[model samples]
Target: MKWLNKNRVLKVIFFALVVKPLVFIILGLNVRGKNNLPTKGPAIIAANHNSHLDTLVLMSLYPLSLLYKIRPVAAADYFLSNKYRAWFALNIIGIIPIERQRRVRKTELFSGCHTALDNDEILIIFPEGSRGQPEQISRIKKGLYHIVHDRKKTAIIPVLMHGLGKALPKGEALLVPFNCDVVIAPEMAEFQTADDFVKQLESCYQELKTYCITTTEQHN
Candidate 1:
């Protein structure tokens, strides 16, 4: 529906009615460091990618007031394969699609993301690039590096998510209900060099993983 695209209210209603319930009620989520989640925009949410549910889970963490402001950075090839999928992703989910296979200018590639940042919109980015194995964190990609290279003012918050892969891994459509773990880290340090910043992100991921282990060990 064109109305879906024209009206932000409808988009907010969809997430409030559908995404929230499906993520919080059907799947169930255990989130820590929620206090670290950004209340406003111009922030980058860097997280590991697993199931498609990862986007929904992350978006649901934000308040309904910020629903329209939250845009997930997704792959153009996968999400925009056809008209129906394109409409849903672009109109409903409000994703900033990046061309993965085709060669495009740096400015053209990250144009949507840049605009989002300029508008103080929160961006949900999976630093791993694409979905990896269920419950396994992949190496942080350089794409995120390019987006934030010059904009040191914007906060980059590292997030560690668990169990979504098992619930709905890559190539599977049916969702198996699972209790998910989400740890939202504090804003990462400002970048010095590309290598240093990426390494810091990877290190942050490891620390969060270790935090999960330490917390589980304490309960045992």
Candidate 2:
């Protein structure tokens, strides 16, 4: 029960004892641009959504000591559908759940994300909004821009991932072991406008996705 309180100690222990092993050992990762991963917080990790593994793999990139500082931005409808799931997600996974269906102000929609960044925590956000087809990138959403438009100092790191969709696609719970690829871009430059920022982010995601696909073809 104590671990269900979002306890830092238990979090460290869980990532160390569980998540890391599952990510690295079972679902093997072939990571490129590992050095581009940020070591500190007040940062945003913008990645493509393919499977549930996307969040776990991104969080596992950080050190165990920094696990407490990692928050994955997830949808409230799916993750918080029930009390038990809400407890596990909030406590064990440490997600910032945002309501997708509620007609609320943009300020309220991302209040939790802003607070996390203000607290110097690293957020793992999927700009595609929700999971799409396996190994496919969807239209980049604008919520990512809203979270960072005012936070000038916050770093935005772009990451493109592949293979997880085939491993565990949306609407399925059974995970099939498959090698996954992660390509991380260096922290992106701050853009002056929301449109400019989202444009640059989308471009970056496309570039990474292309590189990943090309590299996979070469290996095969």
RMSD of each: 3.7, 3.3
Candidate 2 lDDT over 1-220, as tens digits, reads: 6434646777788889988999999898889899999878899999999898899899898888678888999999999999999988998889999999999999999999999988898899999898977777788888898888877789999999988888888999898888888999999987988788878988888788765642323232
- What overall lDDT goes with each candidate model? 0.86, 0.86
Q: List the residue pairs that clash in candidate 2.
A: none
TM for every model, in the order presented, reads: 0.91, 0.90
Predicted candidate 1 versus true structure: per-residue lDDT over 93-157, tens digit per residue: 89999998999888789999999999999999998988976677777778888888887578999
**Model 2: what TM-score?**
0.90
Candidate 1 — worst ten consecutive residues by lDDT sum?
211-220
